[model samples]
Target: MNGDAVRVLTYNVRRDVASDGEFDWAARRDAVASTLRFHRPDVIGLQEPLAHQYADVRDALPAYEWVGQSRNADDGDGEFCPVGYRRDRFERVDAGTFWLSPTPEEPGSVGWDAAYPRIATWVRLEYRRSGERLLYANTHLDHESARARAEGAELLRERVQEQRENDEALVVGGDLNCLAGDEPHRALAGPDEESPLVDAREASPHPPHGPSTTRTDFEGLLPDRQIDHVFVAGCDVAGYGVAADVMGDGWFPSDHLPVVVDLEL
Candidate 1:
């Protein structure tokens, strides 16, 4: 929206878990902080974020503002998706989350067939430069439930469509846990039956050197399969690419790599 294009990133930090067999929570925290510092994204959608982890990032980047609710309503201390952005560049207008089930009223309720509670955080942000406004929604789809993933995709599509009708630039980003060719991706991208509602995954160019944006911790080998993405609607994407920070120091800050995009309002 501003004369300066906004840079956005989406990452899933894997609940600060590391495969190195060394459970140094402090090191994990530092890794997360360093990753953010390296990219310096204007806005970030982080999945599997804990309150403590959020605090670390907030303290490290004092200028950024964030919002999100726990995945579980019971304070079970589990993972959740938290969205953060640089306040000086964008002003938050509204923010909230809804359940991924048929009865979406329950804020933190676990959806049917979902392995864990799923939530989508939505925020309305105003770009300071051009005085343009946009809506962003971030979430992690149910990793193990096919039904839940399909339904979640549909729900997100509907929400984005509603927001687009208001003539606002829209972008959705997150670690969807589904491949670019999956059903969930297709559903959100507007399955063949309707006009494409969203442009996701391959909508942007990927880093040239990394194995996709996701990797398994098996013996530290990097494999291919991009599960993280930045989706956009009602906006023009000027430039986009994935951040290959994982290739540094023989260690990955998280299981999933962060994706960044530059947009023109």
Candidate 2:
């Protein structure tokens, strides 16, 4: 890293249209575009990226190079995780997706108690500043399964350990659906010699009950949970924060706020 740090962001854009039925598809697209433009992260990890949704984001930000893989075992529509990066800032060295199952090879495979298929998308990015490389992994955990969440966390740890053999920085981010001080977070925060994962949420600017990382507008001011997170390893994280895009019109870019982090490779 030419002595300059890189900024990374993770956002889980709700795939469905608004429940209020006020904003059309175009409005939703524009909202997302505006949010991304305002943040301008070096690398972005997005969840619930459908085919059309991915195209919309790409069209809005043409300068970004992107890659995505479906999580549905049946290969049907629904939700998928997609990652995008600034073409000039980072070069993709490698990328792939694996199911959150004991036997991950079987595509569209379902894991224990998982309501739907789950996957983790990983990419090796080379930072232009210092010529340093880092591995990034993004995923959305199953909302309904305890076993899936625990196993998924272990799987991610194993995957990161394997990738660390390459001697690169590591970062993992997504809507884990697990709260602070949970088992899943504990698994990712385990000790390691080369790269120990650290939770960026705990290091955020907001204090408890100030500005939460996520808010469910489904009900009137529903109980908030810090489900979304960003974890870093093998890199020096300068700072991190959650983007509260709640506008005066009571509209947000997504249900979950985007988490941003500045890191030195």
lDDT of 2 at 84: 91
Worst 10 residues of 1 by lDDT: 200-209
Candidate 1 residues 138-238, lDDT tens each? 88999899888888888877766665536787888877778776888887775575534456444544433345546545225456667877778767676
* Candidate 2 error regions (>4 Å): 17-20, 23-25, 74-76, 191-195, 203-210, 218-223
Error of 1 at 129 (Å): 1.7
lDDT of 2 at 41: 91
What does the lDDT come to for candidate 2? 0.78
Off by over 4 Å in 1: 1-4, 17-20, 193-196, 205-210, 216-221, 246-248
Model 2 RMSD in angstroms = 2.9
Query: How well is each residue in 91-126 modelled by candidate 2, as lDDT tens digits?
Result: 888888888888777788887789988888888888
Candidate lDDT values, in order: 0.74, 0.78
Clashes of each: 1, 5
Best by lDDT: 2
Please provide TM-scores, in order, for all candidate models, with all chains considered together. Answer: 0.89, 0.89
Lowest lDDT sum, 10 consecutive residues, model 2, at 213-222
Clashes of 1: 1
